[model samples]
Target chain A: MNYRIVTNNPSVKEVYKDIIFVNGTFLDVLINVRDLVHKGHELISHPLGSSIRTMYSPYRSIIVRNKTNEINKDHIEVIENSIYSYKNTMQRRKPDAVNSKDYAMLDLNLLKSALDEFKSIYDY
Target chain B: MKLELGRIYIKDIQFGNKTHVNNGTLIVNSQELIDKLKEDERVKDVKVDIARPGEKVRIIPVKDVIEPRVKIEGKGHGFAGVTSKTEQLGEGKVNVLYGAAVVTVGDIVGFQEGVIDMWGEGAKWTPFSKTCNLVVDITPIEGLQPHNHEAAVRIAGLKAAEYLGEAGRNVEPEEVLTYEIGTHTEEEAKYPDLPKVAYVEMLISQGLLHDGYIYGVNSQNILPTLLHPNEELDNAVISGNCVAACDKITTYQHQNNSVILDLYAQHGKTINFMGVILTPELTTLEGKFRTCDYTVKLCKMLGVDGVIISEEGYGNPDSDLLMICKRLEKENIKTVLITDECSGWDGMSQPLADTAKEAVAVVSTGNVSHVVTLPPADKVVGNAAAIATLAGGWEGSLEADGTIKCELNAVIGATSEIGYHNCTVNLY
Candidate 1:
């Protein structure tokens, strides 16, 4: 359960000490996760974790295996496929919601669930 | 386990001096119910309103819808673990407010929350439109976290139902339906000739507003497990999911799961109903493989001839559904998947995130992305403008004439994966 949170939601910055905060859309967060996966960090949680409709929410937070090593093919496949599906589903529409904070909180809370398990496993 | 549900059909609802039921009408003391919900400090204010079958009222930003039931003979009341102490359900007599629903309406937490119109074209889509709805509009105290906001609305709906359910405790039901199922061994012995069929109910347990509850424990914390069908009907599993409005399994849906009921109907007649396997759709790929594999193993151990696997919400979970289906087919085990599609507005997009050659027998509840237009209602509850930000809705979805143009995803239960909706796909 070793993981690191990658998010654009400023809400998580105060909570998690380590996070790759990318100031971008939901797609931007997934792309950031992809960049991590390419650099040897495997994804611990699905990039599509909190939602299946990737383009629907304005914010997204992903958890990735923090330890870097040889490339994990499975992680790459998942992230690439996720990015493709996301781009396909969204049809180039920008991330949106009635209120940005509402979507941010939704993403933050879901990330917290995986963080709970990660904390227990990492024993921090 | 044997449970008898006494149904008292409610014909109407009215605000009265005291909360009670008379004849077929459900009378509520608004202040009393509001007071009960406000006891939770997270909830700042509560408003109780009535919307009947053909009213010109529209309830927007709807959260959870719960059925009101009073346990006259059960060990514990319904909504165990949350509204009441942890207790075993599914083995007692409970009185139900058959045609009434407690609908919670409030701030839209995300791209979730939906609309429930009482009449016109909009009414045809949501099953809640047919019930005598006791709309509970809750406003959380300012500065409440989004997670707590969801909880406040969720608990208020459950509490309102609990308080209203008390009125039915004394009223004699019009019909008493009994659901009795013995142990798998006992049933197998008696109905050895029938095809052994079991139900695999895949619940959303990703995270945050994306999880279901088993006796109030987050589904995210549990592995795939087995449950007597009665446990679901009697409130062993509950919905805290705030995903897509069209397909998310509401707490009400768990209480009146159509798949469980349909399986029970054919039990011993067409098939020997073994039991239900509750599988959690997790967020990790590893978790998905583990749950999917473990689920099929349970079905194999039961020696089930066939299984009806129903999914909650779409997308990543679609992969989980197919993984289990693929493995079951590999074992020569029969599986019929029940799900909704996310096909584009043109109905030309791929039906699911993943598919298997073994997924031959699949029942489509409806397409979540299908577009629909709902004419405005005379009276609107909650916020009408909330639809613009909903998953299936856009910034200009709410028009000048109060008309709304959006996908079926914004309409609650329009595409229920559990088969409790009005959606159908006719073969061309």
Candidate 2:
């Protein structure tokens, strides 16, 4: 069970030692996810969450598994596109003020849903 | 499956002594209806109001919009399994109060709630503005979890629509719309020469404020499944999502799905309309792969020659949309997609979050980031200030002169990915 959680979610950071903690907005966290993909860590969850308004939230957490094989070009493309989308959305409407606890809670909930499915796949 | 809709056209609505439709006007017993919704223990209070087309009214921080309908010869009462439990749906008769809607407004989930204006420049952006909206504003009990808050309001909205729908149970409809599709094999044989067409409707099944329900079940937990479009059109499916207001398919949109209805219009004449493939836009990578693969597999199994796919929300589901399209095209199944864009307010950025060379036939349903200015309403139905926290609204979006400026993203149905909207793209 080797994985990493790239996140600005402080709750995930406090509990998970494998977290690559970020202190910026959702777009910044996505850029960090892109950097990991470039370093060959495959995505465990989609860089984008189930939310169409994910870019509106300042908090985010993405799951990934340790590199197993060669760099997956598709993962890189997905992350780059996600970053592009985030930038476009932010230009229109910026993320909620930092410490908007409700938005953070929502981001945590999204991570929890992804982690529930991730546990079943990564453990096997 | 064959379902007949008896539509009783409603042009005006007013609080009256009883609830009934009288010559195109819907009269509601305000106190009785408000009392009924308050019976739900999760709700602390209720406010009922009416906003008609061309009125100077603004409804804000809305949750869902549903058309009022009641079972005439249907197995289930109205919302099957939800409002009342009974046998399956899609083969029964239901009465629809045409041109009228029940709009739920609240701050349950906050950021994703939408706005609806009944007059002026804002009215041109959303379809709901054209309908005579019966607005219900509910407040949840203190300290309720976000999930409970969402459900309390969602179910309350459905119940409100069902309550009002009962008034049309026996009214004589202005017209009847019949949707009948035989089993896949039977249809294939009857229209042997016509192209076999199917519809793929992607639902945002993320939990909490983002979810769509099929027959009283959260779609996120289900796999890709086939359906008779009549089941959805008859109100078997519902929207419980608080996604971007511009693109979130309301329960009203589900009952009158433009894609499903338009396909029925071209049924035997142009194509052998198969049915709808219900797929979930889940939150995890594993679920995305599972559902997208399973969707195309079902289409391939049905021997589908052409397909129309519609997405519910944007961002992550953009990945799911392209994955399904890429797979269907690889199988030689002609594919067409309906989706909205997040290309910024200026429309300069890339439209979709993902892309496939195979998605050649695409339909862009307006830009969600397109900005609009709504004039102040003589009366506001819900909290107008709540927009500042909305996904598309920023601080100062509300002007001192009561002129509010916001993106189309804050306006409900302004960018319906289901093609249930007025915005269109013109090639120059």
Candidate 3:
């Protein structure tokens, strides 16, 4: 029933303690996290380059999220401009029911808020 | 193979000077029937009781229910492997005591035995309530182990059914229903345009209290194999299971399998009923994977377009159900699964322990954990206090006033996975 940190993010270690940490890049954590989950271990995926995928287990629950909001301040203007341009292009075309929203321009705060709520419910 | 089933409807049963069917009434010579069952050395004593459709009676700790059938023609008679000598069944002239069943009760084997109410609200949930039940209460010799006790009761029920079936040997049947499935090539040629469909029936074979028998052979020892659908109707398979009463497939269900009958009803005109595949539900992961792989392999070998899968027990078997469905869909074979859910008492828990995206079409039987209250019957057949330890019951399930408050798990065939009953689950 151990919930291990499967990332090298310094922020994760600061928040959690006494858990096995997988000191590796975010890509490494993504590739081997499923195996850990299969063994009844929960993984807290690094927020970098990840997507929201919640998998439930009786012993533990894995919370996966991307940390795009942690991007360097120098690239903020570029990322903002690219997101606005994509949103404007998507709005000009007819909206399909399944893809009505421009996911590329999603609000990053939503991810943080969701993570906090999941943590409060899952941290037992 | 073809089978001609002669139905002799029985309306009432009572003890008499001799055993015979007269004017829709079954007259049983109680002394003769008792003597026949006492022949088994393991049986210490035998007592017989009759429970009619509307009687205020309750039979508890029920082990198995069997329909009486006598084979008039063909290679073998009665239950192929257990009650009768070993032979390939399915093609024969058989007479069925259509409206009567032999209900066996005795010492408890596992916490999985059930209760059958003859009348009132509780009677509606169990199919055995509607039949004229010849309740057989068996007592084994001193120090008899659980294994032998189960076998003794199982064989006694079959023997009694076989003995009663002899009465219809010379009498004319009220109606005759014939079932036939031609050779593989002949059937394929007859229904060339219709889709070919197969049935996968999972049996509990966990040994000890949990097991099933095919032609008297322990099913846990075999791989997936093909069986003629008609053979099952003639007692090719028997139940040795002691799982939850609600979902376990009894010998009666195996003889009158609704899924096979439903599929056979649509054969030729709408679909080509290929055959049935019998697979065992093992305990270990490797055993499960091996059997499941063999099941899909057999289905592929048959080259069927669609298949219907039915599960016997719950929990661990749910994984096997999903695994088989996932493999079958990956091979492009359309599949529909029949299973009972384990939703909690509030009906808020997940229906199954496992799920697969490929299992899109499913027939959900009622939840096993749903609670029900039953008023006391005027007469209790077996040990009434045994309900306290039943799988779906707790320590205080039985009330002082004789009314019982327990989950559907304590009732036999309440959530039959073979679609034997009308109970189903719907989201509110």
Candidate 4:
């Protein structure tokens, strides 16, 4: 899928338009792109002029991090592992066969891990 | 402002020859109600039914629930602006048909209408399950849009409540409750030592099917404003939004607002109850900033020491709640927030769209996306199949049998943000 970031910061948008080598989930890319824009890097709106060009899942989750507090590589690995496990579990289930409500509860263990890092950081 | 409520407890409801209150029972002439609602050309037909507590009945796609009330004295009548003339309310001798409610149900207005189960496990989730409900199912004219259909159904419910409230006028009440609140200066002089607390209510005003009306005006079209708690208790504000049912503030909850009542209970003793501030949750970013800033400014202007902010819908409106809280805490004003969550069925998602450290003290009114299964009812009022398209429900939610499997969002008042019900969320 083609993922593009449209930002209010014109300088960031101008510099990031030509850059391409991206491989990540739509939510993952949005969070990283938003962080980049917040860092004062030059930015501009996408050519399509959409905040989100394309996304795999309609249910989008945006995780906002506190830039003042840095997270180590180990913490990133834990979160990534959790995401992978959650995705794998979801893929194994037949989404068309079950309703969204029922689908949400298919793998509570995986869901908990997927949200562990966010919950720890936010103190929820 | 001072108001007197004469409560006539209705132990049962029956369809009989006449519409009146007798021996703790409310008798209604269903045909009369149908004729009254049919007067509106926008509505094609009206069906009235009854669902009593502990009955094997299910009411789906419920829109609004209203308590019946009649103004016997004072300035204005019950539902002053809409059902009656636009007059001052809350300082009147009103008669209430306590333990009874006017519940509106019909075709899907939006993907947010809920279900009401009168018995079994589902009964514990919603307050309306305990009331003697006079369900009014209205069908709009052919080709009517959802927005217009919502308006027609809302008016029909209010009209039905006003009609039923009339039955209590001549009959003597079993109990009477009085409420009186003085002006700001009067309260300050009377309770100089008590902490002054105010209530800020946020209304959903996204547009067409999602909106709240105050005195017949859409709240989104106006700025943050002040209101006496009495005005709300007297039905000055009406809920017209089609937000997810669990969190939606129905018209009944507005009249018997739990927060206002509890605060009133502690008025002269624990705290000096200040007036209420009604704020709107707009859809646009600019509108949100404008409204949130104006709300905090009003709180500061009120010179309140503590405030309780209650949110209406979830998702985008969560930002407005935090924004208001951030500003209020900056002004050193103590605050407590009441809201429901959409933390997914597993309760693993974030409870809110935005978060602020200043929002330390909060009340969680259960999770809207929590999954539940309801047994089949012996009899179902309105279309049970309507659950499939509900916000908290999805395709195949209604089984071949009468059983229903859906999210709490499809249940009416399951997670009332006003603290009307006792449901809450606790981390395991």
Among these predicted structures, which one has the highest DockQ?
A: 2
lDDT of candidate 1 at residue A90, scale 0 to 100: 67
**Candidate 1 residue lDDT tens string, A1-124:** 3567888888888788778888988888888888888899988777875344335777788888776778998678778877766765565245665557767776777777766655555545
How much is B338 displaced in model 1, in angstroms? 1.1
CA lDDT of each prediction against the hidden true structure: 0.82, 0.85, 0.72, 0.72
Give candidate 3 regions above 4 Å deviation: A1-124, B110-112, B390-397
lDDT of 3 by residue, B1-428 (tens): 99998999999888899888887777888889899899999999999999999899988888889998788888777677787679989898998888989998975432334888899988888999999999898999988766687799999999888888887787788999889999889999988899999999999775555678999988877898899899898899998864458888889999999999999899988999999999987654455678899999999999999999999877557767889999999999999999987666777766665667899999998987687888878998877656544422244556888778766767888999998887899989
Candidate 3, residue B123: the lDDT equals 89
- Measured with C-alpha atoms, the lDDT of residue A52 in candidate 4 is 8
- Give the clash count for each candidate: 0, 0, 3, 10
Q: Between candidates 3 and 4, which one is better according to DockQ?
A: 4
Point to the candidate with the largest lDDT.
2
Instruction: Give the Cα error of residue B322 in candidate 1, in Å.
Output: 1.8
In candidate 2 the C-alpha lDDT for residue B382 amounts to 84
* TM-score of each predicted structure versus truth: 0.93, 0.96, 0.77, 0.79
lDDT of 1 by residue, B93-175 (tens): 99999999999887746455578889988888999999999999998999987778877888788888889999999999999
Model 4 chain B poorest ten-residue lDDT run: B387-396
